[model samples]
Target chain A: MHTAGDVRVEDRDDPEIIEPTDAVIRLTATCVCGSDLWPYRGIEPADHTLMGHEYVGVVEEVGSEVRTVKAGDFVVGSFVISDNTCEICRSGYQSGCVHRAFVAGTIGTQAEKARIPYADGTLVATPGQPDEDLIPSLLAASDVLGTGWYGAVAAEAGPGKTVAVVGDGAVGLMAVLAAKQLGAERIIAMSRHPERQKLARYYGATDIIEERGDAGVAKIKELTGGLGAHSVVEAVGTRESTMQAIGATRPGGHMGFVGVNYDVHIPGFELFLAGIHMEGGPAPVRRFLPELIQLIWDRKIDPGKVFDLELPLEQAAEAYKAMDERRAIKALLRP
Target chain B: MHTAGDVRVEDRDDPEIIEPTDAVIRLTATCVCGSDLWPYRGIEPADHTLMGHEYVGVVEEVGSEVRTVKAGDFVVGSFVISDNTCEICRSGYQSGCVHRAFVAGTIGTQAEKARIPYADGTLVATPGQPDEDLIPSLLAASDVLGTGWYGAVAAEAGPGKTVAVVGDGAVGLMAVLAAKQLGAERIIAMSRHPERQKLARYYGATDIIEERGDAGVAKIKELTGGLGAHSVVEAVGTRESTMQAIGATRPGGHMGFVGVNYDVHIPGFELFLAGIHMEGGPAPVRRFLPELIQLIWDRKIDPGKVFDLELPLEQAAEAYKAMDERRAIKALLRP
Candidate 1:
């Protein structure tokens, strides 16, 4: 699956259990993430990076220590594997684990099979076997969807809170969906696209503001009694989005950001004077995987709608191009 | 007394009770603040600006609605003139009141008399007349000391937490003192001066890290199992100090900053990646004045000891010169 560009996908030997805590998963579905766009854009340090972190699959083999799921079980795993007992993971932040390692490093889901370390702690088992209908959504629960949900959680979105989502990308759109699930009374989607606006409203955005900068701030304030939104989820990684997130929040509100910030600068005085609580980074997908997987199994929500284009694993190049060209909200690669 | 410099002491009409809610205070002692130094140095707006905001004084008269203190009562007040009954003020953040006003807009404390508005809400009185010896320490509680104390509170400094303080100014020094009184298990003072180091120790600093940036981060990590402090107080308004405070904290930790941000730039990516909770702005000195006054009256702490020099109001220029020249940490002017 090598493209005319960099990063050739070559055939590799099937993954084996490297540790008693590891399990081997036969990939069924994996998708390209907006964060994955970082490397292709020349922002993230790509090098020989395997280039994918979201996946849903069937367990092919399990080591003795893997008790939560057995062979033939359907599952989804987080991007960064961690031992759940560590202080970092125990505190519900698995991405910052002391022994943290990204899935791309060893046998990523973009391939035929992958080895999941700390399998019991990092992977969530679906109820029995997941139907083909739920596969894509469960795969999304592995990273993007869960991350958007975590962003809403970090922003403290809930009833009576007005939430402003600062990006129209997949994650940002999903954040609107998450805020709605969290019972946000009013959701403002900051986007100009007709398609995104439609999706935003369908996902529970009560209002839409396409303005940028001071005008965008003014629009949000006009809709919020001039106090700004109670919560802001920033899903675009840039100085402007960061400032917009801060400026869109009220005096004692919160800003949750999960954008893969690649060289963004903020003015110190503005942040200091804004007085907003900020908390975000790589999302703790593992922390939400179990619940998300359960929700998907129960058919409670359909977050998989974010993937607008689907391609075979061999056509990964076309998938990336579709997303890179902005022709797709998100692209899926079926392995 | 107008000097050859920016600092001037002019004999103005004695402040009288103008509003039914106002009170007149005869200055017992008034001191310069680090923030006040900003205007004196022309870094902030100062032309026609009345000089001080911190003072411990004898109440000369009280308006009809003033019930908290009476004539001849020794009292301390916050820089914010807020009606305590407002929703914002009742939330313990008087500085953010809907109708908030600052002492700087009217008559300041570097005078023989000062007019205090919202007297019942802004002023806190001692049980009885204060001893002359307690005046200096009590006066410090008016702003610098209270601001620093609020910095610690905002940082959530309490039992079993390791706290780091960024800045060695009078406010920072008092923050070190505040953290100690708040029961922080470990206090790391980020200072390089021998004098400040000694004062920090006296204020209960358990350790000192003189290095800065990555090296300082490494030092803090080495001291806390490579996890950073649980709480950090930022009292310097520069970009470096703000970053240091954020960097010096562990994931899920908190940073409380009070330094009036000058020209500082913050990188949004780094802050987002750090995942620390931050909330700060002008300190609500009115909320803490009562307890601080009691502490002063009981002689448990000596925050006013931060003022290293004293001068008659006639020598206001020399006082400013001394502070601007770094010859004095803080200067007290006898009106």
Candidate 2:
């Protein structure tokens, strides 16, 4: 991003293996993220920030210490680079690793070639070069899918549990799929858009509620026999969305929020009297990559359906605009 | 509390068994809570509100349907009345039960006689009428001790866990005892007062930090090999204390707050990256009463050591003043 609402694509020097554990990937695919819009709309300050984090590509070069994948290997990497050996990494919070790096600005994937740090901990190698048909699905595992999965896990969405999705974006819809895969008995998708609502149903939503805020919470409670859902996935960071998510959770239930938070203040008194559990953060995609890759590889799930628009690398601005204008749930960029 | 900052001892009609599940108890002991200070200091609004909740006394009468404790039985009651049969109560969150009732204004325990609702669910029968020596301890089990235990439980405090207590008042001190009883390997008490610090040590605190806020968090991190404690008990509701508690918890660690929150607002972006589990609210004391009573009966733990002052019913006003002035950790009233 060159500036607010401005996107410019230009040729740059190709990345080279700089660290003993580094790998340079020739990008096959990359995409626009909801968070990218934050800087695009100038809600977040930036100066020509190199954007993009989600990626699926073929390894072009590897440092001497790299062992997991070599040249020609197909790989999917998490948005955050982490040294898996760190204590926080080993504790299932790799996203908060002491030596973590965001792929958004420093080593963005939108370029033709990008250097990936902590290759072994950040990249998931495919069995072999996957079919072109599987590219989008594998790419989804890079961030959005893992983030949704993390929300479900954080919310403890599983057997006999009723899960509620608080957003209808790609991540929120993916949460429905994650909850279903995790064995939730009921999945309520909150969406007002017909297309998104239809897609939510296709993703395994057992119920749909278009109401928002207090009414949305009331609907959730009414649907759950006045007890509310056992787990709620908050994929929207707005104040209304978070409040609804918290209100929809039953006492002793959990709320797993994954939207980049924006000025959310949890009223202490309400949370105290509610008796609920809450845990959230950037998803530790590295922790779930193996399982997600296996599932996508086995064709057990198709998370790539989230990408509703596709564009060449040169049309990156259109891709961002497509997502920004709600013309696409997600935009897939080909290099 | 007739109004903020004022305490009055007024005569009133005796409480009678009004519900089929009710029981009347003649109070042997009642006390002021740290939370009471909120309204006493005018931070919280009160209009001639009857103010005490903690109590231990002999059952004076029982309604026709009462079965858990009969007349002449020594009993300990939770501050919140819960119908144990409710799903929420059965789920161990009696404090959030649909049929729950706060005992502060309706049937305050500060009087010579008080009515206990949901007798079978809210009141735990003691092994037998205890000697005068056990009254104070049993009384503590009604709220502060239970609140501390809830904090420990919510924080998942257990064997091999390093737990940090963020206050030095009755609840915080009891958290040390609770964590010790729960098998915490290391219990760090945050307190500057020598008397409270000594008592904290007696309650199984393995370490004590006199510093507070950021410095206190730094000290905790230093003590825990730069990783912070595995679990944190937040017994102070101020923003600084809550922030300290959150800061002192390791990544993916748990923080259970039981402090009566007063306008505490947790920042979103920070918690979103910290990956900490936070759960707090009005404690479901009724859920712990039975086990706590059993532990007390077997002489396994003495939670009552929190009471440092004793006064007659006529000195109720003075008891409140003593506690308000920090002249006593707690005041046990003999009615």
Candidate 3:
């Protein structure tokens, strides 16, 4: 992003193995993320910023210390880089790893190649070269699929649970799939977009709530016999969306918030009175990578369906515009 | 409490069973709570309001439908009344019960006689009351002990975890005891008071930090290998205390905030970055009543040591003043 709203695709030096623990991969697929819009819409600063984080590729080169992936191996990497050996990473919070770094704005993956540090920890190789048709799903596993899976797991969505998702974005849609896969008894998708609503249903959303805010909370309670959902996932970081998610959760319920929060402020008194379990923040995508890759490889989940618009790497600007204008749930970029 | 800093003891009609499930109890013991200070200090409204929510007493009378406790039975009751049969109550959130009522503002237990509704759900009868030495311990179970236990449970404090208590008051001290009983490997108490520090240690706090706010958080991190505590209990209902508790918790750790929040606003960005599990509210004391009563009866835990000042019901004003001035950790009243 040269400047807010002016994303120009420019030629730059390719990423290289700068560290002994690093591995450079030739990009096969990359995509725009909901968070990318923060800088695009000028909500956050952007000046000559590297654009993408999500990526899937075949390893082209590995530093001497890299052992997990080798040249010619197809691999998927998390948006956040982690050593995965630190105490935090061992506790399944790889995003908060002591030696963690954001892949965005540093080693932008929306290019021919990118360098991934901590190769043994951040990158997970597929069983073998993935079939051509499975590329998109594998790419989805790089971030969205893993993030949504984390959100579901954090919300404790399982058998006998009524899970309510509080966004219509790609991440929210992915959470629906995760909840379904996790065996939730009911999945309520809060969305007004017809296309997203359709995808939500395809992902196993048992109910659709077009209403939002207080009305949305009331609807959830009405649907859940006046008790609200047992688990709620907040995939939108806005104040309204966050509060709505909290309000839609029953007492003693759990809420998993995965949206990148900006200026939201939660009133402690209301939260206390709501009496719900809340866990959120940056999703530790690396924690669920192995399992998500297996699920996608097994053809059990099609998270790539969230990408409604596909464009070549050169058309990255258009992909940003499409997502910013809400014309696409997510836009996949092919290099 | 009649206006701020004014507590008066006056004669009034003795409480009578008003509901079929109601039971009238002759108070044996009651106490001043930290929350009571909110009204006493005029932070919350209080005009000729009844006080005292914590109590242990003998059942004096029971309505036709009351079955759990009969007249002459010694019992401990929660600060919140619940029908117990409601879904919320059955789910162990009796404090958020569909038919819940506060025991503080109405049916003040500090009086000689008080009416308790939903007796079957709210009151736990002791095993043949006789030991006067165990009265105070049993009374603590009415609220503080149970609230602290719930806080510990909410924080998931158990073996191999380091638990931190963010207050030195009765509830905070009880949380220390609860964490110890739950098998937390380490318990850190944040307090500057020598007396409270001693009590915290006696209750099993393995470490003490006199620093507060950011300093206290830094000290906690220093003690836990720069990672902060695994489980944190916030028993002080202030913005600084709340943030301190959140800050003193490691990423992916759990924070149980049992403090009755008043104007606290939690920044979403900070909390999201903290990446921790947080659960709190009015504790479901009724849920832990049976076990706590059993513990007290068996002399396994002496939670009553929290009451450092004792007074007769006639000196309720002095008790409130002592607590307001921080001259007493807790004030126990013999009604």
TM of each candidate vs. truth = 0.90, 0.98, 0.98
Give Cα distance to truth, residue A80, candidate 2, Å: 1.5
Clashing pairs in 3: none
- Candidate 3: where are CA atoms >4 Å away? none
Score candidate 2 by lDDT.
Answer: 0.91
lDDT tens readout by residue for model 1, B94-127: 7766557778647678888899988898888888
Candidate 3 predicts chain B with a TM-score of 0.99
Better candidate by lDDT, 2 or 3 = 3
User: B131-195, model 3: which lDDT tens digit per residue?
Assistant: 99898899899999999999999999999999999999999999999999999999999999999
- lDDT tens readout by residue for model 3, A102-193: 99998888888898999999999999989888898999888888888888999999999999999989899999999999999999999999
Fraction of the true interface contacts (Cα pairs closer than 8 Å across chains) found in each model: 0.52, 0.80, 0.82
Task: Show the lowest summed lDDT stretch of 10 residues, model 1 chain B.
Answer: B1-10
Q: Which lDDT tens digits does candidate 2 get at residues A1-335?
A: 88999999988888888889999999999999988888888888768889899999999999999988899999999999988888878999889777888999998788788999999889989988898889999999998999999999999999999999999999998999999999999999999999999999999999999999999999999998888899999998877898898899998889999988867887777777778999888899999999999999999999999999999999999998988999999999998
lDDT of candidates 1 onward, in order: 0.84, 0.91, 0.93
lDDT of 1 by residue, A1-335 (tens): 23223545677787899899999998899988887777777776666767788888889999988888889988889988877777767878787776678786454677778889988888888878777888778888888888889889989999988999999998998899899999999999999989889999998999999998788888998998776888999998877788888899876678898887778877767776675667788888888887887788888888888888988888887887788888998988887
**Predicted chain A of candidate 1: TM-score:** 0.96
Give candidate 1's iRMS in Å, 1 decimal.
Answer: 2.0
Q: Which CAPRI tier for candidate 2?
A: medium
In order, the interface RMSDs are 2.0, 1.2, 0.7
Model 2 Cα lDDT, one tens digit per residue, B174-205: 99999999999999999999999999999999
